[model samples]
Target chain A: MYENKRLGLLYCLPFVIGVALFKLFPFAMSFALSFTQFDLIEPPKYIGLENYREMMTTDKLFPKSLGVTLMFVALTVPLRLAAALMVAQVLNFKLKGINFFRSAFYLPSILGGSIAVSILWRFVFAKNGLVNQAMTALGAEPIMWLGDENYSMWTIVTLNVWQFGSSMVIFLAALQNVPTSLYEAAAMDGAGKTTVFFRITVPLITPVIFFNLIMQTVHAFQEFNGPYMVTEGGPLHSTYLLSLYIYDQSFKLFNLGYGTALSWVLFALVATLSAVAFYSSKYWVYYAGEKERS
Target chain B: MMSSLIRSMVAMGVIALALGSTVVSGQELRFSWWGGGERHEAFLKAIKLFEAKNPGVKIKAEYTGFQGYQERLTTQIAGKSEPDIMQVNWAWVSAFSKSGDGFYDLRKSASVMKLNEFTDNDLALGTINGKLNAVPVGFAARMFFWNKGALDKAGVAIPKTWDEMFAAGKALRAKAGTKAYLIDGEGYDMILMSHAYVYQKYGTPYVDPKTGKIAMSAAALKEWASIYKRFQDEHVATPLPLRASLGGVEKPTEQQPDWVAGNWTGNYTWDSVIRLRGSTLPGKGSELDVGDFLTLPGAKNSGVFGRPVHMYAVSKRSKHPEIGAKFIDFMMTDPEAIRVLDLSRGIPSTAIAFKQLLKEDRLRPLEVKAYARIATLNRNNAITPPAAQFEHPRMQKFMREVFEQVGYGKINADEAAKMLNEQGSTILQRL
Candidate 1:
């Protein structure tokens, strides 16, 4: 028993060491860096609370970026969940050549945030790009999709929503697991297909829907690559998400301390949001094995 | 287990042998730069020549486009993993060399690198606090480059001055509708053009370097903003919305499809970028021509923007600083090297090198013509703009923001000026 335990510990060693060195160490360093004034070129000087104060009170971009990030999350999360659920419903049917459609839909999620996709997206949304060309051909005025501040954020949201394959797969799995007997029973009870779906299918998949909701919400809140690559947090900083702001501050501007401070604020935000999500999930999330509470 | 262990041991031995051979064979240096197709091609040729002469001393060239080069270099420097030889920006001198010791002191290798090849004035630009950290490759200036065919096709003559440019804008818009603007009035372009306007009126640096304060008082800034506001209002340049629809202003005009298509007819850019701009036009059938930088009708001073060309500096962390210095010497002075480099960077920094390029016909006809104009401006009595220290991202962004606010009518000229003084003070104070 002791030898078996030792083997198990040995097997886990690499993962523990990897997390300690790459993840946890950097996490702690960034936290410590939040209090300092560092330009990365010069040695970091401790200037307690100055970076935080500057960001909150003086920097206008901070609040603007935060608002932009929250909007992206609110829009993309619900839309992505809806898209994934609708597609997964159809995908769950035992239809012919279904695997090809599944792979085709999954391609974007697998290749999402890559440079190739981002470049392709720019061409699609550019003023003289294919979409605008088609619009002009149809005798309609061409819209500046990525150029206008009003519509630029939607481009990134559309890009994010299109890559809903992971959530769809999870929904598909949960749909398959729902016993056919329950649907038949509801059908025999003089219920129509829509009635059976509402009474039988949905409640049965509440656990999976709740899971996807939380996952997509977190993912949408931290969305960076889609906006960074597509819109460049630009056209008057319209698409400037919080993650992009942090990256620009830390990497582009070399204000690592301020970047760290911004990241910590983001961490608190995401943590609070996730906590709220979990608390709310308890009311709606049904479990397979747990007894129902009166 | 024995077979696998033996295989692992052999692998380790092979790794060690490979590492040992690299160290024993010769010095390996990494040289990094950012440029367009022309520069990358020329630099690759220069590297090939350098490698052939240096024998076992290998130099690896790391190249990228100009975007994010500074940011990447900053991170690499912070990590102490920068290239040995760097194509350093002039503004980076003030940024990285606080004590004048951020880069390797090239003075130590003067004999090998041939420091006497450069004129004193050229040498002075790279010298900081008595430390020769970098050497200027050439001197460059910002000017107006017009596509002659585009304007001629529209029956618009080449604009020789601000009045002509304004008239051209009116005529072109009447004739071509929204087909073209006199130039791209991106935020930075507007700021530079505003400097020329303001400097001609007030013979002083935009910002007082000594006090680290803006030279233009709130009243002066207000006047400047009003003039700038007038320029944009008259539609002499592409407005923000149109420029945005076109593409990023930071990208070379050549890279923009609008520019290639002759929808944007002129550019306000540096001399170094003119060829790249020209190269992008011929394929699209537009004839690139050097036009006169627009001046006020009776302008007091040219207010010509001039600066040292991009320089080569060695990282203090480089294990092979000597080899890096030798490479710089070859790149800057060698006859064969100059033939390969041509005039991709700019006119050569040294007189001898220029004569060589001219004699060998290495400098293209257009380059020679461009150089004559630049030489005339260089010799003119003009107000030197603020030092590169003022080229900080914070200051540049602040300048652009103030101009943008005024241009967009988000705020009035007086408000923009007052806000600039207040916020500019804060920005300077932090630095």
Candidate 2:
């Protein structure tokens, strides 16, 4: 048994080493660096809460970026989850060549965070791009999807919602696990499809919904690539999310300490929101065997 | 069981040994740069030639497009794992080498490098704290280039002065319609444009390098911001909203649809990138023509912003600084390397390379014209070498934001100018 344990330890060594070196080390270092002023080329000088003080008082963009990030989260999370659930409902149906549709829907998520896809998204929403061309063909005046402050947020939100395949796949799996007997019983009671979905389907899939909400919320808070590549937080900074601000401070300005401090604030916000979601899940989320166990 | 344990231990040892041996052997040096395709190809050919001539020395080339290059270099520098040689920006000398110890001093390698080939003025541009930190690749100044076809269609001549340019803008709009503007520019261009205008009229730089403070007074700054506001209001340049709507603020003007189609016609840009900027115009590059330097009436200075295009620097952390220095010398002074490099990286700054290229008649006609104009400007001392702090990324962004606020009517010129002086001074002090 000891020999067998040693073999198992050997097998896990590479992964253990990788996680400690790459992930854990950086995680600790970033936390330590938050209290200091460290330009990339120079040694860090301990400043002790000065970075936080500046963020609240001196940094003009911090509050605005936080507000914008909150709005982005509020917009993207629901829209993306709804899109995922809607697509999952249709894809859950056992139709011929259903796998192809599943793959096609998943394609965007695979390519979503890449710079090339972001560039393509920018061109797609551009003034003389395909969407505007189509609008002109249909006798509608072209909307400045990426240009106007009122509409720029929607472009990034739409891009996020369009890449809803991962959440959709998870929802699909949850849907398949829902007992068919519950649906049949609802149908016998003369429940309409809408009633059945609300009564039988939604309750059984609440756990998955709860899971997806936490994930998408966290992801939306930390969104960088979409705003970075697309609008670049412009048109009066309507799309200037906190993640983009953090990146600009850290990488572009080389204010590593202040950026790390901002990152911690973002992490704290995400953790609190996630904890609230987990606590609220007991009321709304129903597991299959949760009642039985109780 | 014992044999199996021994075998596993041996295997782990072998793997560790393999990983440890990954470092390159012998006299190999890493060199990194960022450029467009033509520059990359020319550099690669030159490197190949250098290697053939100097047997057993290997240069590992690392190159990328312009985007994200600075961030990558910064990270490498922080880790103390930078390449032996690097292509650095002129503004980066102070930022990277504040005390003059950040890079390998070229003066130390004067025996290996042909330091005498370059002029003192050119060398001084890269010197920090009396240390020759980098070698200037070439000199570039912002100049006007107009689309002759578009100007002709609008029945307007290239404007030689500020008033004429504004009049021409009005005339072009009247003839060509609202979609047609006199110039297409991003926020940075607007900052430079206003700087040139303000400096020519008021004879003050935006920042006083000697004192390290905001040199433009509140009234001067007000005029600076007001002129940009006027540029937008008068259709002399594209409105901030229109430019933002068209593409990213950082996107090259030449790539904009309106610019390509001849609706957005003129640009005040670096002379170095004239070929790249003009190659995609409507008339297969024939439509482009250099315009006279715009000046205001009663101007005290020309306000032509000129500086080194870029520089080649040897890393102080490099193990083979002498070899890197030698390579830089070859690129700057070798006849064979010069013929291969051509004018891809602008006109060479070194006396030997510049005179040779001109004598060989290898320079393209358009560049020759640009060089001649810049030469004339330099001879008269109309061109001022910009303070390095003026090109700091943060400072540039602050100016752009101030210009943008005025352009968007979010703030008046007085308020914007106050921000420029007050807030801009704070930023400069921190730097």
Candidate 3:
């Protein structure tokens, strides 16, 4: 038995070693890097909280990028959650061609980060692109969809929102798991369809909604491809998000230490936000045969 | 069993020694560059020829459009995995090859490379500190290029002077209506012109290198802003929003459809780049006319913007540095290599290559005429070295932002000048 246990340990060694080397080591190194001044070509020199101080004090683009990222999260998280829930509700019915609709809806999320889709998004928003061509055909002036600062972020937001299918799938699974007896009991109580939904369906699915909300919020905060590829953080940086800022600093400018510090701030922000979300879930979330926590 | 183990270890040592010998005997080089269709094809052919001539050596090519080449190259450099050979921009020398230690010093292999082919001034452009880091690819000077088809349709002849160019703007608008533009002068183009004007008037560097200060006065800035504002007010150039719509200032001039259609007709770019600019027009290559460098009537000098267009450098970390330097020498000075390259990478940098190209009649008429005009202006010695920080990315951002603010009416000429002064001082403190 001892020999068998040792054999099992040997079998698990590769994965254990990989996790420690690739993931844990990098995580620790990144945190350490936050306190240094590194320009990649030269060895890192320790500067202590200077990177943080500069980011908070003199870096002009930091606040703008943070604000942009926050705005994207505020806009995309709720919109995507609401969209997914609505589509999932519609998909929960015993309707014809429902699987087709489900797959069709989920396709965008699958194709969202692809280069081909990003190129298509550019063409769809370009000044002389398809949408502008359509406007001209309708006897309206063409709009600078991607060029105008006021509207460029909207193009990226719209592109990101179109990838709501993944959250919807999760919602759909949770909806199907919702008890039919609860609906029957609510109906027998002479509750209308709206009342039944509000009291029965929504209450039971609150936990899934909470899960999707937290996940989508985190994903939206870390979103890079849409703003990076579609609008390119341009038209005077109207859509410059935190991820693009970090990328430009670390990769393009080679300010690796500062970029790492900026990332930690972003990580802290996401963590606090997610923690708040979890704490709030106690008020509204429900689980089967269980009372709310405390 | 112990005897068998000893025998296996002896055999493994033999295999290791054989592998080490093979590694030393063969070399593979990686070369990277950015260009249009012509340069990519010509460069690939050159690589194939180089490989064929040198047995036991191979090369891997990496090329991309200019859009993200700098970012990608910088990333590779940061990762310490940059290619063995690279085509570097003139502005990047100080940033990447500071003191020439950042790249392989080609002077170390002087026997392979004929450095005397290039003039002392040309070599100086590629030198950082006392160490020669790179070889200048070609001589480049900015000149005005116009679409003859559009200018003729607007009943405007090619403008000969700055005043005539302003008049041509009016004539074009009068004949072709408000939508027609005399040129497309974005922030980069306008700021360069602004420096040219100031340099001509004051005979001073626009930005002092030692201090990073805006050497021009507020009155000089006002004069610069006046010309900038006049171009917009008179429809000599398209509006900022319109330029943004066409894909902002960074988009290649050749790729814009408006430029191809002769709507955004004229440009101020390096004379070497005119071939690519004209090739994009509806008339293939015949529509562009190489006009005079926009002049302020007998102002001291022409204020020509002259510099090396491109350069070739070897990686400091490259294992096969000697082989890479030999390849660069062949590309730059080998007559067969030069003929194969043609005018793909602009006119050759060396005097010998230029004479050879001229005698071969390989250059187009437009190129011949453009170089001739540049030659006349070079005699005046008005050309100045671009400010060390002038072409740096961050400084270019600051320069572009000033013009953009002016265009947006967020700040006037005097306020813009003050902002530049304050910002320039702050940036210099860090340097």
Candidate 4:
């Protein structure tokens, strides 16, 4: 046991050092910077809560950006989870060329955040892009996908949903782990397919769905590259998310202190939502050995 | 596990070898600039030539696209890791040069550049606090560009004044049955042009020279916003929805392809963009023509006309300061390099380099004509410096927002004027 503990310590030393140096240090530094005025050049000067206070009261764009980001998260998270689950269910069936389909769907998620994909997104949603071409073919007026403020947000949301392959893969793995005996017992009991699915498969995969939901919601809140490359937060700033606003303030405008404050505010929001989700998970999420009590 | 350890050892060995090569005996100078692919190729070739000439000096070139050039340079400057030599924008000269000891004074070094070969105006642009902190390489001024075939098809004459331009746009739209904006006024150029016209008419620049305060009068703001509002209301411009989708400046022109297909008219752009777009358009090269710069109707005597294009500065932290200065000298004085660059860095400001390229028959014909016209006009006009607010990103964003508000019809001329007055002044004061 002592030898095993020594081996474990040796293996974990690198990881512990890495976490302390890369993650914890930066997190603590940014937390401290939230209350300071530092332009990344001069030494930082503490200004109490002035940065946060200004963001709350004086910054007109902050509330609007926060609202837009929340709306995006609200719409995209549920739709993406549903689509991913549906696709995973379809793939779980025994079919020809199923692996190829799964791989093709998963490819976009891997490339989603890349510059090449962002450029492709711009071309796909341009005024006279493929979307409009299809619309015109359908005997409808060509809608400006990226130009109008009303439609631009949908383009970003659709981009987010289109990269649901990662979550779908997770769902597929969870589905595979579901025991076959449960389905056999349901069949023996003369339950319909829908009832079997609802009572057995979905309940078994509830933990996976819960996991994917929280992860994707956090990711959606930080979506930046799509709107930045496609519309540049334009059409009268309708598509401006809090992430893009923070990036503009920090990098483009050189307001590092204010940007850090915004980041901390975002952290607080994400943490609160995650905490709520975790607290509520006990009611709905099911584990492998859990009783089927109400 | 043994193979993994061996692989790690090999990686460390390679990195150590790379680091060992960095410690060369000769003085090494690192230079960075933002440019397109062609400019990068030309610059690399010039660096090779410089290396051949200076046996003891070595240069490392770093280049990137212009999209985030300023932000990257500012970060490098802040980190105190800026390259030995940097190709800087003229607007950023104040921002970088204000750090008194953060930039090298080129005039004090014996082996540094001699500014005598450059023009008086070029030298004047590089002088800050009576010290030459940078070297001017080129000059570019905003001018009107037109698609001759489109204009001819629409049966409209090129306008020489603001009123005539508006009338011409309306006539073109009617005849073409499509939008016919004279120019898509984007970014600071539009604001600068508007300010010039207003300053000429009122006989006052945007800044008061005596007090060093912003003079963004409510009347001027209203006038500027009204012009844009009129452009939208008259069906002369494509609606806000269409214009907002157009991508970055370096991207290919959306309207140009349509203009070639006989759907739209001209745009206002730099000469380089005009040439680049014209080359790609599916028409005879002569179909595109350059238009003369227009003046507001009441501002014919506008003295606000000059623009600083781009400049080169040496970093204060450079180990090889003389090598950096030499690179700047080559950028300013080398005739072959100038011809190879050829309006990619704008027109050469040095008289000798300009004459050498002209003699070599390497100058683009349209650029030559354009430069000649600007020179003739510049001889009689006063060259006003760029506003201090131009360097502030907040001010740039505010200007863009004001345009957006006007374009979308969310606000009227008076409201935009009010917003501009309040926000613009606040931004200027903060800066």
**What is the lDDT of every predicted structure here?**
0.80, 0.87, 0.81, 0.76
TM-score of 2: 0.97
After aligning candidate 3 to the native by TM-score, how far in Å is the CA of A239 from where it should be?
Answer: 1.1
TM-score of chain B of 1: 0.89
DockQ for each model: 0.46, 0.64, 0.42, 0.50
Please report, as a value between 0 and 1, the fraction of native contacts recovered by candidate 3. 0.33
Give residue B291's lDDT in candidate 3 (0 to 100): 82
Worst 10 residues of 3 chain A by lDDT: A2-11
- Checking candidate 1 for backbone clashes, the offending pairs are none
lDDT-sorted candidate list, best first: 2, 3, 1, 4
What is candidate 2's lDDT per residue for A1-294, written digit by digit as tens? 998888788788889999999999999999999999988888999999999999999988899899899999999999999999999999999999999999999999999988898899889988878888999999999988777888889888888888899999999999999888988888899999999889888988998999999999988998988998889997788899989888878877778899999999999999999999998888788877665535
What are the per-residue Cα lDDT tens digits for candidate 1 across A1-294? 876677677668879999999999999999999999898889999999998898889899898999998989989999998898889889988899999988888788988768678767877888878888999999999888876878888888988999999998998899999999997887788899888777788888999988888788778878888887777776677888999888878876668999999999999898998899789877877888979878
Give the clashing residue pairs of candidate 4, or none: none
Q: Where is model 4 more than 4 Å wrong at Cα?
A: A1-14, A188-190, A291-294, B1-26, B185-197, B205-212, B246-256, B283-285, B300-306
Candidate 2, overall lDDT? 0.87
Candidate 3: residue B169 Cα off by (Å): 2.4
> Model 3 segments beyond 4 Å from truth?
A136-141, A184-197, A292-294, B1-25, B185-187, B209-213, B222-226
> Going through the candidates in order, what is chain B's TM-score?
0.89, 0.95, 0.90, 0.88
Candidate 2 CAPRI level:
medium
Each prediction's total of clashing residue pairs, residues at least 3 apart in sequence or on different chains, is 0, 0, 0, 0
Query: Candidate 3 lDDT, tens digit per residue, B38-140?
Result: 8999999999889989987888899998878988898798779999999998878777865679999889988888899987877888787777788889878
Clash pairs, model 3 backbone: none
Candidate 3 per-residue C-alpha lDDT over A54-130 given as tens digits, one digit per residue, 9 for 90 to 100: 99998888998898889888888888888988899999999999999999999999998776787688778788888
**Cα RMSD to the true fold for all candidates:** 2.9, 1.9, 3.5, 3.4
